[model samples]
Target chain A: MNLQVELEHHRRVLIVRLRGELDHHTAEAVRTKMDEAIQRGRAEHLVLSLEDLTFMDSSGLGVILGRYKVIKSLGGKMVVCHVNPSVHRLFELSGLFKILAIYENERTALSELEVVS
Target chain B: MSEKLEQISDHDGNFMTLQFASRSENEAFARVAVAAFVTQLDPTMDELTDLKTVVSEAVTNCIIHGYDNDPNGVVTITARIEEEIVTITIEDKGNGIEDLELAKQPLYTSKPELERSGMGFTIMENFMDEFEVVSNLGSGTHIRMKKRIESKKALYN
Candidate 1:
């Protein structure tokens, strides 16, 4: 299946749930959507929920890294949750796990961010 | 010795080839085709996932780096299966890499402005049993990879 980006805003946090494949073919759309959402919503924190995501490549890592940089520059944080093993492998390969905190689920991510924000 | 060689040759050699334009839309198509072809070996979910990721990485490099995102450029993929081992080669007819070493370094993307993580080669190397690159300054790039599928059937045997 193609990629789908679903956004949920909670207070100043924006939760993006990605489904399907995220690759070079679909990364640009996801990047644009997330950037616009962050700006329009004035989101101070980002939570990426990948429970339904089936596939991701380095292009997906680039998108995640770019968004992390954006949020970091704004003095905010970005965390990812529900990452499948395949996607987690990419995160490890790219050294992204060093920078981005990972949670077990969306509720846990939101609660953790709540304590911080 | 002749009998041993004959037995080796008797092994099945299944293969498929694909050719498409260097367009972003075909990225998914290339990976999925390779994954589908690999199913004959009955790869586990993780192995299948790894194969798909490697295919995506190679195809992306062909489109973005080799062809410079030129739709007119052509990309080709050839996959061959011999017993439990799968070998895939992805090639592109575009401007070739000037420095293969730098290109393969993790987090060293030539097109940082495009938000490339420069993890393409790294991912391919990490996920596959064998990865090789052949490229010239103006001739284009060829990536060859091989992985032995340890299917449940193979394990049971």
Candidate 2:
């Protein structure tokens, strides 16, 4: 019912690990929490690890898309890693993969973003 | 509407009904609770996930679009697994959709300002083997979905 958010910083890249349900119920809180983290001036890029994400729906997609816009507006990059196949299908259905890269793990995502973790 | 979970079973199949307020938190409850019930069927992880996703989308539509985010509204969820097939119905007594066709269109949301992706119906359609939407403007909305979960035997042979 509650999403546990863990923040990791690698230089300017912020890795957010989300564990729990990411539906409409928790999307607003996530946006607020991550938005605050992003505004802290420590992040030039963002990476999300959803390895433990138990569930997600369109509202979750909206939150991700919303964050992508914020990062794009700042000329920074956003990538999502460790997406379960069910969630990955949503990214494909919503055409998010075309804009945001989906990586197998945090290591691959950091490597692709050219940020050393 | 009573908020208690009631069980009613017959020869057709055993069914449980859950009635709760139209609150965002219930969206999580709807999926996880139903997933827990469906666990007895021995559904694959993907099958269970699919059911939960559709349940979330349907309940969300009822809460946001049907009830207009009003906490007083009620949403009723009935889930029954008879044999290998599961049937679920989510209903709300709130303002319903005016245009079913437009509403089901991918990426078409009545409230884009709310950051709605409008993929709720689409996901429901894709996840469930059978999806049906019944709504009337100024009335309410009812969604019925069913899927024949792949049993372990089917996967092996």
Candidate 3:
């Protein structure tokens, strides 16, 4: 369960790039890290970059949804980018695509967040 | 579902059963082992990924839902490869699901505090060709899933 969470504070948006597998064993760490970052950095929007995410299960969906809720409650928008086919399917199945905006890369996601914020 | 499981037992195929403590860490090991086991059939990358995801889902359910994250509980996985088909059955001897139907619904997590997506069963069913769950109230849950792998060997021939 190797997952790397790299966060970059771009203006008022936080660009989070995740690499490796995200599952039940590793989701907690990500949730904690993102929660802390969101609160501490006071991000106005979030850009989740999953370009290097090799695998994700329902647990991954839960963590992403949890963060989405956190950002939503704070009056911030959260967008996801670089989702692989399999992870994309999970997002579609869970209906997260309907609520969250998706982009092709971190730059686009950040730019979109910038416009909205 | 039991009859289908019996059919697999009666057939001649490569099979392996793994028994381990219901620890969260074992979730990775369980899915990887199953993926490795089915490698002999040479599943496609998508097929392999689907199998790995379902295994993770079932094993996670055993640890979280069945065993309640009790590391002391035992989780068993039996996987068999017959021809181009792979069958995996995950079992646990812990608190069984009280309402199996409700448990299968999407976004219906019993433990919302844990942030469970409640998409485990749905993923398992959609990813595999066939999926079934049989569990008793006091007993544990048994998840049996079967997928027909379009092996490269068959594709070329």
Candidate 4:
């Protein structure tokens, strides 16, 4: 499975639009790319746009949890938006929804981050 | 809900077994192959995703904790389909789990340094209708999962 990561620079956040499957094969790349984007952007928050994310497993959960720790340690927040039902169920089962903010769309996430910022 | 549904409803009974080296790459292949085979059951998107995730977790365990990342070890997956039900068995001949209870606990990973989420078994239990795990210290681990795909006809009612 190939993961296509598109990083968009916002004023106080990095908007990460991920496409394709996020399994063991592509988790490492997503982690690397997201870390780089967060560091390079020097942003205070992260908005993960998962509208196009097709699939995700526990490996994907581990990566997301690891990044949540990273952004948390940095005192930045992370929000996931446009999650499909399948991936959303993964988030629910992994107990990620308790820690990560979920939004319906990118605009909602950006606006929520604006308030936090 | 997809084109794959028609192809599966026509088949009566299908069974297949796949065994390969306990390599990380083989995990992806195991998932795709089993998922492809299961399409014959006309599973919904959610069902297919759940099945694939379960396959990946089981195979990954075989490669990592089962064989300790040994490329020489082997992982075998057997899938059987009857009507709307699919049964998948993942087997590995490697050092097995020492504590079955601890292994099943959520967020309990023997190797935390590897950043394992420890949600593999949890996901499998939740996704499939029936889940079973058998392991011994030196023998190996076997995971059997069964799920019944609900057809649209059943949903309309």
Candidate whose DockQ is highest: 1
lDDT of 4 by residue, B52-102 (tens): 889998988888899998899988887888867888999988999999999
What is the lDDT, from 0 to 100, of the residue B141 in candidate 3? 94
Query: Which stretch of 10 consecutive residues in model 1 chain A shows the poorest summed lDDT?
Result: A35-44
What are the per-residue Cα lDDT tens digits for candidate 2 across A24-113?
988888998899999997998999999999888999988898889988898899999998889989988878889988899999998888
**Runs in model 4 lying further than 4 Å from the true structure:** B1-12, B152-157
Ranking by lDDT: 3, 1, 2, 4
Docking band of candidate 3: high
Give the Å shift of residue B48 in candidate 2: 0.7
What tens-digit string does per-residue lDDT give for candidate 3 at A1-117? Answer: 588999999889999999988999999999999999998966789999999998899999999999999999999999999988999899899999999888999888887878887
DockQ value of candidate 3: 0.83
lDDT of 4 at B20: 94
| TM-score against truth, every candidate | 0.94, 0.92, 0.95, 0.90
Supply candidate 1's per-residue lDDT for B127: 92
The true-versus-predicted C-alpha distance at residue B61 of model 3, in Å, is: 0.4
Instruction: Tell me the TM-score that candidate 4 gets on chain A alone.
Output: 0.95
Per-candidate DockQ vs. reference: 0.85, 0.75, 0.83, 0.59
Fraction of true contacts kept, per model? 0.95, 0.77, 0.82, 0.62
What TM-score would chain A of each candidate receive against the reference chain A? 0.97, 0.94, 0.96, 0.95
* Residue A66, candidate 3: alpha-carbon lDDT: 95
What residue pairs clash in candidate 3, if any at all?
A: none
For residues B67-101, what per-residue lDDT tens digits would candidate 1 score against the true structure?
A: 88889999989888987899999998778898889
Indicate the docking level reached by candidate 4.
Answer: medium
- Stretches of model 2 off by over 4 angstroms after superposition: A115-117, B1-11, B152-157
